[model samples]
Target chain A: MSGREEILGRVREALSVPSHAGVKAVSGEGVRDVRKARGFLPDGGATPEARLKKFRKLAAKLKAEVEVLPDLAAAGAFLADLAKTEGWRQIASHRNDLTNSVLTSLKVPILWTDDEPGTADLEQVEAGVTSCEALIAQTGSVFVTGKGCGGRALSVLPPHHVVIATLDQLLPDMLAAFDLLRERYGDNPPSFVSFITGASRTGDIERILVLGAHGPKRLTILIVGN
Target chain B: MTSDTPAHQFQEDSAVSTADFEHRQWMQDALHGYENTRGGTEAMFGDFEQARQTAAAIKWEAIENLDTLLGEFADKLEARGTRVFWAGNGKEAVDYILGVCKEHGAKNIIKSKCMTTEEIHLNPALEAAGMQVVESDLGEYIVQLREEPPFHFVFPAMHLKRDRISQIFEEKLGTEPSSDPEELTMIARRVMRQKYCEADIGISGANFAVADSGMISITENEGNARLTTSLPKVHIAVLGIEKVVPKLEDLSVMLQMLGTAGTGQWLTAYNSMIGGPRQPGEVDGPEEFHVVLLDNHRTKLLADPEQRDALRCIRCGACLNVCPIFKNIGGHNYGTTYQGPIGSVITPHLRGLQSYKHLSFSSSLCGACSETCPVKIDLHHHLMRNRRNAVQEKGGKMERWMFGQFAKVMTHPKRYRGSEGLMRFGAKLWLPFKGRKLDPLKAWTASRDLPAPAPKSFMKQWQAQEREQEEGKS
Candidate 1:
């Protein structure tokens, strides 16, 4: 018999003896109700201000550069000032409402993701600037998708990663982020859905923290809000 | 030495490791740092113990209905144009991966950290097939360059100091010695930049397989996995059959707990879910995506309900961090793909009871493993239970025989009195040889003095007391 048949047969035989101590499993669709279990997870705050405050707090702890600007105009000014200080020659980004509004302020050469940019060229750029789907407050994570956030590699390949997001994009926690994903693209989801938490890091050598192992070393999130 | 058994190998290696105070201190210091950070991070949870219960229940649900969830996971993956292969053992899994490499005429392969691949010894097989495999994770890469298996499952090169790591790089890569972690990381990052672009296939291991969403989730502190999957034309994920969870949203509960428990972070740097090859409109990803489901004695573990909960292991290394035995003996001494308390409990079932039962017996039965386990496997009890199972299976004959003799002497009054006298005589005679080479209690007495046995038996003393009382009454 094939591996599938033999393995399934073995599993069926093994599970015949009922041993679960009354852990009720939702039959049919087989997706157990997780709403109750989510309560056990760290609670994101109830109000928007509390969530925003929590996001900044976590971002600071992770050593990520989080700038909460009053509006997009102020964000653009901040980016322009950052561009000058970092001495950036070019920025890699994909065209979107967020990117379109902010690109003019950088006043630097742009490497567009949609233009079929070479991988080597993408590597040499100063930073990859993209718009994220949501900013998760509970873990201080940015949710990105292949189709939405300039494909899979753009946000990760460059040395520095800059995420431009609006206040409305901030979600309370991971569950809300997952719910937003299901609502946006349920059946035919994007090929890659990622939660980018803080900068790329490693503690592999004598358990010492080293930033920018293979991905971006610096992750700057600009949240434009009131 | 003539025995040449794994049990003997474990003993010899353990002796070497435990005596090396420098090595033991390194392990203890690393774990001490882990404990302090993990304590605070765990407190960030709304209810840490409650979170553990929920994680355990979800894993329990996943394992109990393994067949259905696995089928659903496969069906959904296949629906999205991903090829699915089932391998009953490690050899089959390796064969399937080799066939994929051959079909693509692959040259260089880039791999992220995957303990499942290590479990199957995938790299050696691939290299023997003439494919160059480069480990991308910093620790795995360091250990790979040193031509050794990972020292710890998570911290693959945890045993090596920075100077030692620099020495390895100098010997292998003709690079200058540098002790700074940032410089060493840059050295690897610089070297692998071209390999990711040139590699034909990328192999990864999934932390959880979401059956409902047809996606496999990978958690990593570094972005090696992200680059591995994104750049390569063919992405293959090999996961154990027991990794299946019911829904994608279940990650909402599992991911944060995994990050905190595994590395003492609120969350790891990147958590990615890949459902299939790149879609029609998507800009980049692998052209072909393959998912290999490996059973490899997991069904044997599942068949025994008493030990079945062990399959819920998330490979978080939390149990290892808390285990006193692991800290003392270290990882390589266990001689298994996994090490520490979890390895001891499950190795007997995964490998064989008679051969690996020594691992189970080596533990101090402190129950620290059970308490530290996030998925809540009864680890210490399982270790004890493995002892019973090993004996019942006609193993541990020497122990059983000795106990049988003990039971016989205790049952008869004459034999008890006679043996008691003999023991006292023996104790007196044994005093000179206590810590000598000829001593039976030499191993115990070598470190410290053993309390001397009483000069007279309890029965004789009691009889004398009764005689004196009778005289007093008269």
Candidate 2:
């Protein structure tokens, strides 16, 4: 017998579950609806202003720099200032629409990668910039999909990562983030989706907190008010 | 690796572990740090009990429908171009991975932190097949360099001091000796960065497998898992069949519970949900994705209704952190890949009751483990059940005889009163030699002094008080 058949047979025998047991197929909408009705997700903040406040506070606590800007132009200006202060000669960025618009106004040298970035290209770059899919307020996590900057490499390979997001993308919690994902992607989701809480960190060595382990050391989120 | 000989070795292992004062001191400090951070986690989730209960229900629903859910997950993953392999045991799983390596002519491999791989001893097998395997997790790498098993679940090298780690790095990697953890971490990062880019195959263990989307979610504080999957030409995920949830929505609750219960974080630094290989437009990811579903002895645990809840473990190590015996004895004493309360309950069934039954009796039965369990598994009760089953299977001749005599005397009031006097007389005779090795009381007296019995039995004192009360009334 095939290993799959044998294993499945064993599972049925072990659980004493009938072979014809009717397992309900859960749809994306059904999951969202049920989770919404359950109300188990913790409340981040009641108002958008309250959420923004909580987001900024929690993001800072995780050691991520949070700057709330009035518009994309303001965000561009902040990035330009940050680049000058950090002495970044070139920044690796995804060639997405939002990133293009933001970089067009900034005078920083932008290195755009439309394909898989070579290790040399990623290692040489000082910073990476990407537009996030959503921002979770409760955990201060920025949700990025495979379609974001350089797929997964740009967000992790560089020493510095800057996420440019609009205020409207902020959600109360992970559950709401999933709800928005289902609403946007339907059945065909990206190959990779990451919820980056902070810059790369490791407490593996005697539980000492050290940043910049394989991923960006500094995570800066520039939130533009809609 | 097997529990057959562990019952006899447990005493020696525990003695060695406890005798190391330096290790014990390090463990105490680490435990304190974990508890302090855990307090912050509890505050982050205001109603942790409600969250735990909801998480438990989700696990229960998923496990009950394991057959259907696993089938659906396999089908969906196959549809997404991920080759799903079902392995009946660890050997089968290892052989299949080796076969894949040969097919691709892969030589070097990089692996993330995976307890399942440790449980199956996967690395040595791969190495024996002429492959160089590098462990990327900082703690795992330290233990790997020392040629030792993980001392703790989450903190693999919790027993080692920073100075010792410095020595290991100096010896193994020929780096300058440094006691600073940050410097040590940077040294490892420098070494492992090349391995990730050079590896032919990357392997990982799934934290949760969303059956609805056929995606594997891996949570880690470091980005090693992300690099392990993204850089390799072929990515293989070895998962125990039990690590499946029914839907993606369930992940929201599971991740919350796991983050708090495991490392006391609101969310780990990275939570990646990976599906198949690179998609049509994706620029980076594995060209080939393979999922190995392992069912080594898990089916046996699933068959038993009384102990099946043991499979509900997400391996958060919360129980180990809270266990008093584990704190004193340490994880290596358990002599199993999985250790502490959950290990004691499942080791007998996974390895065999005859050899591992002693672990069930090793606990203090304080019920702290059950209370701290995120899934609300009745862990202590399961240990008790193992003890009962062990005794029923093979009655202990001395224990049965002694308990039988006590039962006879306790049922008869006159015999009990007579024995009470005899016990007082016996204690007076035996108390002098209690400190001697040959004395029967040697085990009990070695660590503590025996408390002196009351001058008079409670029954006689109670009767005398009643008589005095009656005389005073008259």
**DockQ (Cα-based) for each candidate:** 0.60, 0.45
lDDT of each residue in A110-134, candidate 1, tens digit only: 9888886777788889989999999
Q: Considering summed lDDT, which 10 consecutive residues are worst modelled in model 1 chain B? A: B451-460
- Chain A TM-scores in order: 0.91, 0.86
TM-score of each: 0.95, 0.93
Put down candidate 2 lDDT per residue, A85-195, tens digits, no spaces. Answer: 999888888887778778887776776767556766776788989989999887889999886556877788778999999999898888887877788888878888989
User: Candidate 1, B391: how far from true, in Å?
Assistant: 0.4
lDDT of 1 at A71: 85
* B255-324 per-residue lDDT for model 2 (tens digits): 8788888888878999999888988888878889999999999999888876676778898998999888
